[model samples]
Target: MSLHVTNTLSGEREPFEPHDPDSVLLYYCGLTVYDPAHLGHARAWVHVDVMHRWLEHLGYDVRHVENFTDVNEKIVAEIGEKGDSEASIAREMIGATLQDMRSLNLKRAEVYPRVSEHVPEIIDLIERLIDRGYAYESEGSVYFDVTAFEEYGKLSNQRLDEIESQGDPDERSEKRHPADFALWKAGEAHPEEGESGGQTWESPWSEGRPGWHVECSAMSMTHLDESIDVHVGGQDLVFPHHENEIAQSEAATGEEFAKYWLHVRLLETGGEKMSSSLGNYFYVEDVVDAVGTDVVRMFLLSTAYNSRQAYGEDALEEATERWERLERAYERATAAIDGPDAATKVEDAELRETIEDAREAFVEGMNDDFNTREALAALLSIATAINRHLDAREAFDYRGLRRAVETLEELGGDVLGFSFGRADDADGRVELAGDLVDLLLEVREREREAGNYDRADALRDDLEALGVTVEDDAEGTSYRL
Candidate 1:
């Protein structure tokens, strides 16, 4: 089946057909660098990262761009708390956010365009909007004339008339409509100018920074083509942010802005959205520090990408257990392939059909909008099949074992981004076994010296049960299977 994604643009699930099959352009809203990124941030980016990986796995070249809003009111607030300049504080936070992204194992986008660095391009886009009559300058501020755009709320599926009633009152400016959003704001002139006024730049309107929505339009259009293949973010950005982007970008270029509008649902705890504004967010760093990156990443991808997921200690623990099961299955596969005679050889057509069916199910799950939960279930089935094959204890077929091994690596390593291997080198297996023996011997000797003979004997018997021969000599106790 062709890949299908639920598009927010049309409010329907549609087949994903790229403008060009060879390369796809994807843009996602990056973090605002004023505060530490939380679970909400990680969930959005993780789903986007998984999309990038899946597309590449299916042999499509993807150029992904995620932008950072480094210059904003929030950053100024953080700067005030730090007693430092905005630039200095923003610089510090940018570095820290990148580190947090790495902890989440999020893929580095082709470009990380920062709002501060792309001011000139932002101004240029505003000029285009103004020239096209989609925007106008009012009292040293540029606002997108929402009324000029006929399809203002088409992307969000909201009627203009319905929204206008609840729109912000245009008390400060000569806005034609209350729904008009700021493209640029005039930098405040006085009152602790450096701290309160915010970063400024020369523009047609006045010396000031680009508004939040405008920054994304300028950066996305500048790096990617005018019309991108995919535009993605959290579900929350669907209203004013994405709605405005569609208006400004499409109006400026007189073309479609993005073909697919994909939005990941929010990550919740106990069915409540994780938000920085409401003070219900857990930092990615704190999570990684608690359980390590692997568990956190695996758990994040264990659910359907677009579905709302609840995250907490219980979910993470379950993820850890699932990962351990995969790890043990891989180990058993490696150990069972001990020699030419010991391999998992599935020559029967029925058995091969089972494995192939699992593979097909896995691909279908991923192809159908990245349903990772279903894909993971298929993966668990593969692992179980491997365990059953090992238990049969027949002469293992190298061909069957190789196919199973490679399939697991493809699903776990490429799709899930895990590294599970049991052997290291040519003599690696023997070396590891020998090292384990030597360590056990040392512990046994220590136990004997400490007069804990019962525990030492128990350890010796356990090794014997595993087919390791034990002998006591003047040098020490030696064990071999």
Candidate 2:
């Protein structure tokens, strides 16, 4: 089946078709480097990362670009208040963002263009807009003429007059219309805070920085194609940020800015939108620290991308349990494949059919608008089947069990971005300790068989002191840490 995605532009589920058949160009709006990234940012980036992985899995060469708004009013304000250089503040926060991305195991974008690096391109685009009458200069600032673009509000479904202007209220008098937004601000200082001279470049309008919206338009088009296959961000950016991007980019190029617009819905905490002002926002590092990266990624993907997800401890706890179950299933499958009697043939029709059905369902879920929630369910079903087979006393086909393990690794590890390493491998000592524990358990089994019950019990007590639990049953023995 072909892929389908719910395009925010048309508000419809459209079949996936890139401008080029061999490649897909995707641009995700990245963070403004004023603060560390939070869980909301994780939700958007991780979803797009999965989409990137899935497209590559489907044999499309994907060129992904995500930008950084390093030269913004907020960053400038931070510079002034903190008494740091613009680059210093931005660099620090960008480092934090990258660290958070690593923690979440996100695939790095092919291009990470920063606004400060794309000043020349931004100026060039604004120049074209001015020459084309899509924008005008006011004193020194350049404002996009919202009235000039006939389809200015098409993407956001708002009429031009109804849309309110963002940024400095003082600039309202200079705009042709109240809805018009800045293409370039006039001064080096933030109009409101009067924080000046941190990051400015030469421009026709003024020696000032690029506006928030124009930065994305410049960076994305410069890095990717004039027309990209997909432009993704949080749903909250639909209004001024994305809407202004469409207007300026299309106006300058006289072409469609992006073929498909995909927006992930806002992630809420305690039924409220996660925001710094409300003090309910949780950083990505904190979440990863609390529940782990895999659990955080799973929790984000557990819901539909375009649906609002409320963050709660219960949800995270559930994700942790689910992840543990999949991990255990993977380990069990690995052990079964390494068993002494395993062979390379599928003798059981039911088990073979179960694996095939799970694989098909996983693909079906991903094909249906990248519905990760459904895809994850299919993955869990596969793990369940594998566990059931592992528990069966029958001599399973080694190749069939190996195939199941490979499937899990591809879907769970590759597509879902799970690192299936030992859960306690953080300090690099867990693997050695695990091996030692395994050796002790083997020795204890020998003692039990030789009728040395007291010695075996003593060994078990020592193992418990080291935080290992031993369970013996018909399957022999198993240990957990």
Candidate that scores best on lDDT? 2
Worst 10 residues of 1 by lDDT: 164-173
Q: 346-402, model 1: which lDDT tens digit per residue?
A: 453444555688889989998998888888887778778777776774666556655
Name the regions of candidate 1 deviating beyond 4 angstroms.
164-172, 188-196, 338-341, 344-351, 422-481
Each model's total of backbone clashes = 5, 1
TM-scores vs. true structure, each candidate: 0.83, 0.86
lDDT of 2 by residue, 1-481 (tens): 8899999899999999999999999999999888888898899999999999999999999999999888876777776665467788898678678878877889889988888888999899999999999999998899998899999889999887688776689998898788888888876755244444567887876777678899898998899978999999999899888999999999999999999999999899887888766778899988888888889988999998998799998888989999988888888888888877687654656667788888899999999999999989988887788777867847876776777788888988899898875555654675788889989988998998999999999999998766676778798789755
The pairs that clash in candidate 1 are 343-396, 343-397, 344-396, 344-397, 345-397
Against the unseen true structure, what C-alpha lDDT does each candidate score?
0.80, 0.86
Highest TM-score: give the candidate number. 2
